[model samples]
Target: MVELQARSLRVKIAQQWGSLGLPFLLVAVVILFSFLSPVFRTQFNFLSILRFASFIAISAVGMAFCIMAGEFDISVGSMMALVGVLGASFVPVIGGFAAVLTTIAISSFLGFVNGIFITKLKIPAFITTLGMMFVFRSLAYIYTDNVSVYIDNDFWLYMGNGRVLGIHFPIILMVLCFVGGYLMLRKTPFGRYVVAVGTNAKAAELSGIHVDRIKIAVFVMVGFFVGISSVVISANMGVANPGLLGQGYEFQVITAVVLGGTLLGGGNGSLGGALLAALILGSLRNGMNLMQVSSYWQQVVTGSVLIFAVAINRLRYTLMGQEA
Candidate 1:
């Protein structure tokens, strides 16, 4: 009876981890950082953290959907690089607004191509995205001749660095994206279909869920979000360097999604959790910078955190009597 009670308690904890555990962890991180550095608790610093987190969190929203739908897009980092450079190049010919729209369209088309190869060609997602990753990065380098395209458009600049009512635009964008993501995931039939497909594609197909269409849609979403992120990032930097703009971006977004309690095997996800996790990461990096931690060590710490998150996920699965 005692063992059974303990098991039940563990299951309860597992069930609530995504919604409850992540928030508490974020609070704890904030408190710890506030104590460690007097400058860390300032409103400016807090807003800065939010702005930084917004970049990863926004993409994480789409990544959550894709992973929940049982697909992965490892090419997003390269996609951002290619899209950023391409959009910046378009600024001279099409102007900023048109360039931004073109960026999104191009990225979406790339995602559609990925989906076609994965679903129609029956290629594994891993292989398809991996190949596209190399292709996209190469194209970016080729297009620029290994050069950086500088951006000077006022509208493009405002997207990432502008402020409204004293709040950073990126922060506001992040909140809006999360709200939209929440609504889409929890309040729509498409959301239900995604979950059903992720949970079991064969069963979802048997029930008429249109598994291929859902997967393709999710991939498109991944592209759409990444396109937004690319614009923001390039705006912030005022230039799009094909090689550097989105370096290691895929890892950061994936880490945020996984740490947010989205199971790698799909069927479940948490946008709130992803948002909080992104903030946590931003805070950690900011705190480490304040404390003068080495960049290499920061990478080590971030990687360790991802490993810890995966372990926790496995434990949650075990406690809930689900396969890891």
Candidate 2:
């Protein structure tokens, strides 16, 4: 009886860990970095981490939704590049606000196209997005002639570099995005439909969920968020370089989504987990940089962390009595 009780207790502990592990790990990492480097504990550095994490976290919000709908979008990196260049180029003619709107609209349209190809043509998401990735990147280069478009608009610049009451604008935007994502995921019928579709498309369709529509909407959401990030990134750098902007961004955003406890297979996800994971990644990079770690070594560390995240995800599934 005692042995059986202990086993049950262990299972309960594991279940709790599965739910709360990322936040705890984030706290532990912050504390360790604080102790290791006095600068890391400083207010400025703390805010810097938030600012840096905001870029990934904001994009991760839509990614969480996309992943929850059992879809993938690897073209986001190139999408951002294309949108950034297009948006910046439009600023002088249409003004900053209008250009921002144009950027998001174009991105949403691109995402809609992706969804149409995936759903209407019945192409696999991987192949559709993979092909789009090349197409989008090539368009950016062709349009820009391999040149960087400099951004000079005051409002456009403020999106990334502005501070309000001593807090960066991007950080505030990140918080708002997460809050909105949480509400959408936890409080709405659409959110429920997304999960239903992801969990089992056939079942969801049978229940009148319009699975294809949900998938399309989620892809559009992914594009919308990536559009926001593109604006912020170009604003921060004051230029949009076709070849350099958003390079490898898909990996980073997906890593945050997966690490935050979202299953790659779909159905289950955590917006808060993704937020914390983004902060953790930001902190890790900042701390490593402070310690003078090499860029190559940072890549190695990030890769290892991704592997560990996958292992933990499987363990969490096992602990919850689910197939991984």
Candidate 3:
């Protein structure tokens, strides 16, 4: 009886360690950074890390949905750039609030286009999104006349930089996105549909699930999140440069989601894991800056992390006797 109990405890701990590994890794990174740089442990610097993490976390939540639906969006980085430039351009003519709304609508429409091409046209997601990436990025340049749109409005600035009771607005918005995503994915019927479609589309379809519609809806959902991210990014930078707004953003968010233990092939994911991974990434970047590491090396680190994450997932699948 004692042996059986001990085995059960071991299994429980193993399960927990598998699920909560990223948080532990995050804690370890924090401890290491704190030791390396006193500023790493400071409240102000901590808040700064949160601020940076918020942007990626918001997008990662949406990206997580896409991955969970057995699809991915490589165009997110370019989509963000296009939305940011477009949103910034409208700020002067339509006012800040209207501009924001317009950008989100455009983002949704673009996502809808992507869904149509993939679902209706039967194009693979990899090809569709990869093609859209260049198309959207080019459009941003064309629409903006290859220049940056400068928004000097105080309200726009406040959206990115303001704090309420010492908590930054972006951070607040990030938390809200995460909570909303978590509830939707875990509680709602739509969430179940997403998982079902991802886990096995043929089975889900035979079971009366609208797999195509769900995929489209998820694409639209992620577009909305990307729109929000574009606004925050534009506000933070004070300008929406077609070339710079969201460069490399897709990789960062993808890395965060994958590192958080989301499967690349879809079907399984955790928003909480993505959130923690985002924090870990943000913390690492900050720590590296504090250590005077060159900015170029960050890209190398990101690439390495992505490779490592995919490998880890593959190993997990192998151990579980499942296909990755």
Q: What is the lDDT of every predicted structure here?
A: 0.91, 0.92, 0.89
lDDT of 2 by residue, 1-324 (tens): 998887788678767765678878888889998999999999999999999999899899989999989899899999999999999999999999999999989988999999999999999999999999999999999999999999999999999999999999999999999999999999999999999998889999999998989999999999999999999988989999999999999989999999888888888888988998999899999999998999999989888987898898888778766766
Model 2 lDDT on a 0 to 1 scale: 0.92
Relative to the unseen true structure, what is the C-alpha lDDT of residue 275 in candidate 3, on a scale of 0 to 100?
94
- Could you arrange the candidates by TM-score from highest to lowest? 2, 1, 3
lDDT, residue 27, candidate 3: 93
Give the TM-score comparing model 2 with the true structure, all chains together.
Answer: 0.96
**Candidate 3: TM-score?**
0.93
lDDT order, best first, reads: 2, 1, 3
Question: Higher-TM-score candidate among 1 and 3?
Answer: 1
Off by over 4 Å in 1: 1-8
lDDT of 1 by residue, 182-254 (tens): 9999999999999999889999999988999999999999999999899998998899999998888998999
Q: All candidates' TM-scores? A: 0.96, 0.96, 0.93
Minimum summed lDDT over a 10-residue window in model 3 is located at: 9-18
Instruction: Give the Cα error of residue 166 in candidate 2, in Å.
Output: 0.7
Runs in model 2 with CA error above 4 Å? Answer: 1-11
